[model samples]
Target: MVRKKREKDQEIGGFLKSIEKIGNKLPHPAMLFVLLSVIVIVISHFVAKNGASVTYFDAKAKEEVTKSAVSLLNKDGLFYIFNSATTNFTGFAPLGTVLVAMIGVGVAEWTGLFNASLKKLLINANPRYLTPIVVFAGIISNIASDAGYVVVVPIGAIIFAMAGRHPLAGIAAAFAGVSGGFSANLVIGTTDPLLTGITNQALLASGIDMQLAPTCNWYFLAVSTIFLTIVGTLVTDKIVEPNLGKYTGHYKSDDSELSELENKGLKKALIGLIVYVIIMSFLMFPKNAAFRSFQEDIGKNTLKEFLDNGLIPAILLLFLIPGLIYGKTTGKIKSSHDLVEAMTEAMKSMGGYMILSFFASQFIAYFGKTNLGVLVSYNGAKFLDAIGLKGLPLIILFILLSAFLNLFMGSASAKWAIMAPIFVPMMSNLGLSPALTQVAYRIGDSATNIITPLMSYFPMIVVFLKKYDEESGLGTLISMMLPYSIFFLIFWTILMAFWMFFKLPLGPGVPIFM
Candidate 1:
């Protein structure tokens, strides 16, 4: 029986190895986006020349609209390409939020606030609950933006090693929650506003007058955070930990107690955070307040405006102020120069993301301009309508499709920019809510993040694992994570189904069905 199990594991290893190899052969993410942009251009011209167009009912316009290909291979298109290059990169949706949030995060990180706080957190944590704590922390780290990947994931390994457990299991658990649970969080994160912006844009492009709230999926995400935390803990303790066996690496745990200055810094940072929250609430909750109003449209007043227009900067300040306070208290920032350096380092890391965004932005813009997304979605909706696949089953298929697409594209925002315009309208037409489609996309995107080689952080995860197990590679990382990914997908989907059955809202004013 042991031999049979070994043979099965061998087979799985071989399969994952093959998958990694094939995935490695794909072009870099930026190049792939350029290639996709070129494909959209070619397809645009081809469709234009062939005079192919689709007539679909425009829900917002309350009329049948003819959607035709708009080729980007001509003089006018060339002008747009040239003139829009700078704006495309600058205006790429996720770029700004990531940059702004990371500034504060980078300061906190450089100042040793996060490190001190993390060490302090696990200093006295119960041995048995360590995995759950790590997993839950990973889920909550979403509120701090990408800090989860940069801090929590690696710290999980160190914490596990301190507890004499398999560090790789800790890494797996953290990565699963951080990436696989990326979209779900208890609090609004940079991603929430980022995605909502894109979703709202797609809605407008599709001529819908509806506004998508940043909190539209908040309730569902909070529930998902709890669910993923539990599942991640179980998988880490049972599946991933057992598979990894034990820690045999030479990496020592830095269990040094938090120093007086570090404790002081944390307390100062906490005070800053609490005060910031109070200020924001005062601005938002009071009648006719700075961030609230009585006369604005429902979901459009001061609070909504604050969320829609002010959320990104508000989050930036929230992190920046606390981080600054911590840095000053910890003596990490002797002057303004130190703060600037911290911001510079943060921006430095995002250089690669910016390059990728340049190409991805163009691809997204051209695809939208050329009407490819619209036509494809129209045809796709027609096919689904013809086949009578509406409701829950269709939603499940959309989730699977998103999951499959995620294997090739690592950038969540890029994938969603393309997919949302297609699926959102299509789902809306199918008597499903656009928010429902977005939720499905989020589910599919998260479930496979840990297992995909093409995921931006997949290599980083392997690096973390290799610190403990030199034999760790893409195959090893994927193999251990495969169970977590599978379980997350199954359980998350089941939860969503249950929610749909109960007619529960996915978020504030966001329903499952139209």
Candidate 2:
């Protein structure tokens, strides 16, 4: 029996090795984006020349609309390509957010606060629960938008390295939680309202006379938060870590005990962090909170607006203050010049990611300009509609379709806007609730996030991996993450099926069947 298990493991290793080899053969990340951009240009021209178009329900327009591919080979297209190059690079979503977040994290790292705190945490944290804790943190981070990718993922690596484990495994585990479990959260997050808006629009356009709530999937996702944590932890321990074999990279596990000064710094840092949290609480929780939206549409004192807009700066301050406190306590940051140098070093590390983001931004921008994503999504939905599938098979296929489309499109709300009008009503006709359809979409949308380069944060993750292993390439990252993706999709689908079979409520007062 042991021999058989060994054989199976070898086979899996061989398969992953092949994937790594093939993926690494592709161009460097920057060049790959350039190549993909060119491909999108060529394809858009060809499709436009043939006059390919699709008619689908537009939730925003509240009417059926025809979308045709815009050819980037045309004069107008060339003008746009040239005119938007600067903005494309500048307006890239992840670039600014990551750089800003790193400024604070950089201070923490430079002051040795991270190292000290990690060492103390290593001694205090139970080895048995560390993986689950990291995974759980990743899951919970969804409430703060992209905070997980920028903060939780790299910290995950540090935590593992401190524990004398593979840092890559740590990254994978956290990424799996942050991206793979994106739709599963204990609290209502920005995604809820974003998706619920589209769902209700779909219902309205279809004349259903029923509106879905933002918390439509809350109950199920809350449960899934725990479910995915267990699954992610198991996959990390049983499959991902073992496949990685052992940590043999530039990062060595630091088992050194913290000195008295370091201990004092950590205590000071903790106090600083608590103080920061309390201040933020006062600003956020009050009826007339400082960060609240006073906009007529969103209403006054809305915490959601703060979460969406103010959280990043708050995070920056969160780390910056604690780091400064820790640095002062340890005499590592003696002056203003030291603080500037720490932030400068952090930005220095991000130089390579910025270059990659420029090309990636163009590729993403070009793809959107060409309207290929919309065209493909509309056609895919139409194909699914024509297939006349029902019951479990239909639900499973919708999940698969959403997962497939996720490879090409990164925005969850955007994709749902295009798909909801079609599937929500189609499923309604088949007696499934729109909430159930949205649940299926979320499952598919999340499972593939780690593997897709188009995802805004993908380049940042590459940079993180390179810090530990300079030789790590797209293939290396993909091969590492594919297991998590596959297992997540498989088990998440099964969980959905289980919910369906049991006739469980998807959320508060939201049933699986209409």
Candidate 3:
């Protein structure tokens, strides 16, 4: 049995190594977008020349419509390429939402509010209940984007070591929650707007005439946060800890707790959060509230306008208010200049994302201008119809495809930018909602993040691992995380199936079907 287990581990290690090699050979994500843009231009010219087109019934219009590929190689296309460059970058849906959201998030993170809150959650946990708290804290860290990777993950290791448990188990549990639960969160964060903007852009460019708010997946993802916290804690206590054996390593764990001032700041931040919530409630809850619309024609959906138009700013303020309060209480920010500098630091970190957005925006623009997305979606819908691949089986297949693609490409937004334009509309034609498709894509993208060496944070995880086990390497990290990835994929997919079977609303007014 021992020999057989060793052989199995060997095989798995070899397979992951191969995936790593192949994935590494792929271009940088920004460069990949550049390549995809070129491919779209070339393929569009060929398809247009061949006179290929698709005819499909438009449910919104209640009529049949034909879509043909538009060649970017043509004179008009060349002019568009030059003339629309600035607009393409500016009009990118995710650009403004992400930037606006990040500015607020930046203030919070810069104030050390996010870091202190996460540490407090883990530090105050009862020894017996530490695992779940670590996992839950990791999951909650998603609200601040990549903060969990830097803060929770290493702290998880230190906390475990202090508890006389295997630090790698701690790392596994925290990493599982942070990366594996990337898509699942209690509150709508930057990711919601980021993905929703891409989904809306795809639908609008494809002439779907429908829109979704950033909170479209909030209800389902909130539930998933609890579910994954349980799963991550179990995997750590049951599977991972036992496999790791006793900690014979001599690495010392940090025993520092949150400072008194930080605790004070956190309390004040909570007050700030409550005050902000109360203020927003007055604007949204009352029938005659500023954000609420009491039009009889819109039925019971009085807050639809706020949900659609005002949610982003609300999220921005949710982070900004608490962060500013924390900073003031902690003396992290004493003046307007200090506050400006903190915000500036946050923008500095976003320079890479901005670069990526420029290329991604161009790729999405090129894809839409060529009309290839519509043609592909129509034909793909027809193929799926012919094969009778609608419903659960189809959704599972898409999730698996997304998981497979994640092994090669790590960025959730980057992968979705390419996939959303094709699948969102195609799936809609087959009776699925854009929200449902986006949810499936997120499930796949998230489940595999822990195991993928290509993930941007993978190296950081390795660094955390090395602090406990000097001998640990990429294979060690992959092997340790493999169980979490498998279970997440299986159970998360099942949860998605459950949602589809019951036709549950994923979020407010967001249904499983179009």
Candidate 4:
């Protein structure tokens, strides 16, 4: 009877496959970025030429521009594109951050430190607790930079396969925790500093007399970490995994034997990781330590400076030093050639990402050059501020607006770059703190990342799915993950609204309102 049921399921899948050939027809990510960019640029041009005139008060104070597409597109014109492209080439693009962070990550992954540790941990973990464990690990993995996407995600799939569950379900759960819960984490990460720097710049641009700390949203994010972990676990098991049904596809098991040396190496890696962290904490904790920031002002502490300015070095030592130690001890890497080879192998895996990023960067540059994002955000914020809306309604409206804009512009920093200057100031006028406003912006930006095809990581996720089921395509992956996206958008928005209504502080020294 079970065999017959399986056969029937396969037949049903075949029938549905014929009815939906949607995934195969989708454009390549590179082409999609290029095409969408051109469309937005053209629309911006027309908007600039014919749209109503409005004045913006900022660095370019008293700026006036028509709402016509042509006028909007011609606002900054080629200058914006040139500047954005230059920044991309200079390693400031998101791709650059991922690439640089992966050097250390590559060493760790190549030395089998990450995989072996995960396997060993999972081996002892209770099967019933796997969902939450994987989800939590995904969120926690953010501290290791792009390691969440590369390591936790695939391992989730593999673990699920070993447990006789659909691997895609595991992928969905992990992706939800990693990308959907992007703004929520137990620990600070490279993104925290990167985004805080941008937010600080925006605040400064508004002529605000304040110091925007990177940890401004830490408390709220920490709470959110717990919330998302529980919610992610529930949604994965109750909704996502069940909907995915049983695994009928071929999947590799994780019962393979590990060598004695590999086991010893993992043990050494664990010890090295702990020791490295302790040393780093010691070095960075003291005010006059060699590695501490050389700032003299007590208020302007060195720890803060290091958190903001020296994140790259922090990431390197946090992962690389431990990884090098593990490799040397484990015999995975004995010579300089081995180290170089590990890094080189990691770069080779990034070939697809580089291609995707090149087009994504161009699109983002074009979008900025056309000034559509700026014009829309400016006008939108102006309209909202003109009204007397306050508290929850205001936040809900902004979240929705942010989500809508996300469909067209995928880069969080880039979109915030355009929106923050206007929204922060506008919200400030309405008696809201810039930190609160920034947190709201982050929620909206993160909520939709899982659903948006325009996201740079979206294609990579699709690729990950194909590994489990050769026939799986964009539609299958999107369909499977859509529930989580919807749940996150609604639930996270509600949580933010509640937080606002309750007058909660986002983090230490962070205000709920201006």
Candidate 5:
């Protein structure tokens, strides 16, 4: 009977593996997005020609589609496609944030600053506590753009392997922190302003007189940082790490010794980074500084104007200055040619992403033009509001809906761009804060990033996995991350519920509800 059971398990595993093989051969995520968007656009045109209408509930009221395909194809609707496409393709779009942020990141990566620092930090840190520390650091690293994805994740896998644990477990833990904890960082990053800008636009669309501050969720995120770190650590060790059992593969850990020059270079980079930050802070925040972006006024404060206008440049400089200093100190970049080469190397790595982004931008723009995203979000929000759901049930439903939508639409901002206009207003009508609604949306959006193959990083992770086990592919990666996803979803949901029950502030100057 025992032999028969073992044979049966083997047969099941084989069958599953065959299915995954077929799935992995499908078109890349970018191609898939483009194809789907084209289909939606074509179908929408036909539907408009036929004057097809879809019914949806909103603001606890019933709504029916009144516009036709031709109507949607007009200048106002068509303009959105071109406009959104431009935004998506440019550095302002959701995809652009990662790519643009990577410019600085790639430089730092090329300069060996991150690699050298991680080796030194991990070597000195306690192994038993290293897992959670790495995960927490990954979450914090989001302020530095794609640094978390490129630096922390791969290093995490290496760290785990060195500690005599499964390397995949390290990847999962780091992924949970980097991707899953994306919206839960303690410090506000570039994404905060981006998301807030969209949220403010949505609020204005609803005729609300409000300013959605970028750091609105900072306090809540700080608390969540601790919560997620604990959860990531526990899940990695108790659930993910144990399941992989012993490492049977011949995956050698990174043992390359850091050169003396590299060590000195890192010290110089750190010192340079500090000096750059101090100079920037003085320029941006000093009371009597001439660098203030706006005149002090009752309505427009100097700090506010600076935050609105100068943050992007600050973000760019944060990476560029440190990176250049590191490169120069390490002798990796002594001349203008070396500097240009560093930037070129960065762009070269982005070839795959650029291809993906082109398609993703087209799809998102086309979908927005067709009003499919708006239609879906409006109807979904209406239905939930009509049901009069509140508290945990409302948040749980939102999480599932966001996760479902995430599979088809990988861009978080695009999805939020559509959903926020409808959901924020609908929830506000039901006496909930738009900030709280945004928080719930963020929670749902982030939890599934690790498991979703549509995510741009998903393919890169699969490539990483392939290095460890040749048979490892998309299915292997997704299956390994599935536990983390499910666990994070439950844990985060519960934490949100607890926060709501206690009526805790979601962030700085942001209430949990109205």
Candidate 6:
């Protein structure tokens, strides 16, 4: 048995090493993006000269439009590219969000608050439950776009390291939950409306009078959240973590052991947290408050508005206030200058990310400007429409196709826009409801996110993983996340198939068949 186990371990290690070797052969991530941008520019010029164009329904515009390639090689294109370089880097979603969140994170880390508080909690808790907790948090963190990648992912690694486990395994688990199980949130996320709006537009354009509710797939989304949490937990414990072998990073476990003064500082931080929460409640709960009066949210879904607008600042403050008190109490910060220095130190760590963002932002911008992603998705959907696959097989194929395409296309709404117009109408004609189609799309869209290097947060995750393993690269991430992606895609497809078999309502009064 020992020999067999050793053989198995060797086999797994060999396979992973091979994958890493291939992945590492690729250029550095920043250069990879730079090369991709140049490729897009070349492809765009060729396609434009060839008059290659595609006409599809645009959900946002509520019309059918021809999408033609735009080459960045042209004078106008070159000028626009040059002009937008600063904006592209600055507007990169993860860039600003990560920097902002890290200000608080930096102070907390510098003062030893995160170490002390987490140490106190984990020291008393059972270590077995850590995987599920991280996974569950990742799933729920979907509501705050980019925040999970910036915050939960790194925190998961830190927590795991503190618990004497492989930090990369924790990072994988968190990224899976945050991206792989993205569509499965207990509460509706911004994705619900964005996707539903496209589905509804597709239905209307197809001459169907019915419209989809934002929560059309609520039942499936909520159930998948629970199942994914369970699956993610098991994969981390049984597959990913064991495969990681063990933690051998420089982040010392003894660093988390709280000193007496640090514990006292933690107590003060807790009190500050309580006061902050109480103040927030007075502002958020009351009908009339200075905070509420300043903002305008006509959509009645105050929760969405609050989460979308208020959550980040709330997260910033949640960390900042507690961090300030902790640092002062711990003697880590003697004055305002110390706090400023801490924030600067945090920004310093992100120097690598800032460079990565420049090339990545350019690639994303060039791709969008060329309409390459949209054209590919639209053409693929048209091909799928040409073939008349029906029933469960069709749904399975659709989910699988979505998962496959996700590796190339990262934007959920952009892919949905191209697919929805074609699939929603196509599926509805076969007696499957638009809600069912949307649910299948969601399942596929989410499951592959963790494994894709093209994802915007991909570089951010690499940066996080590098903190634990200096040489960790694209192959490392892909191999680590592949199991969760495959498990999620297959299991989610099966769950949706089961849901369809029962002829159940997808949400309140949202049936599977028209």
lDDT of each: 0.75, 0.90, 0.78, 0.71, 0.70, 0.86
TM-score per model over all chains: 0.69, 0.98, 0.64, 0.76, 0.72, 0.94
The digit string of per-residue lDDT tens for model 1 on 278-317 reads 9988887777678764433244444544554566677667
Candidate with maximal lDDT: 2
lDDT of 2 by residue, 1-514 (tens): 9999999988888888788789889989889999999999999999999998888787866678888999999999999999999999999988888988999999999998888888886797777687999999999999999899999999999998888888988999999999989999999998998898888999998888788888999988999999999999998898788887777898876688888888888888899899889989988888887877675644555777777767888889988999999999999899999999999999999999999999999999999889999888888888999999898899999999999999988889889989999999999999999999999999999999889988888888888889998878888889988988998899999999999999999989999999
lDDT of each residue in 375-445, candidate 3, tens digit only: 65455434544565777898998888788777656667756766676678878898899999999989988
Report model 3's TM-score to 2 decimal places: 0.64
RMSD of each: 6.3, 1.3, 8.0, 5.8, 6.1, 2.4
Question: Candidate 4 — which residues are off by over 4 angstroms?
Answer: 1-24, 51-54, 59-92, 140-167, 186-219, 244-251, 257-259, 294-299, 303-339, 386-391, 410-438, 453-463, 466-477, 497-514
In the range 392-506, model 6's lDDT, one tens digit per residue, is 9999989988988887789998898888888988899899999999999989999999887678989899888888898888888988888899899888988998898998889
Best of the candidates, TM-score: 2
In model 3, the Cα lDDT at residue 19 comes to 49
Q: Tell me the TM-score of model 2.
A: 0.98
- lDDT: worst 10-residue window of model 4: 59-68
Better of 2 and 6 by lDDT: 2
- Model 4, CA-based lDDT: 0.71
Report lDDT (Cα) of residue 312, candidate 1: 68
Error of 5 at 175 (Å): 3.7
Q: Which residue runs of candidate 6 sit more than 4 Å off their true CA positions?
A: 1-12, 255-257, 285-306
lDDT, model 6, position 36? 84
**Ranked candidates (TM-score, high to low):** 2, 6, 4, 5, 1, 3
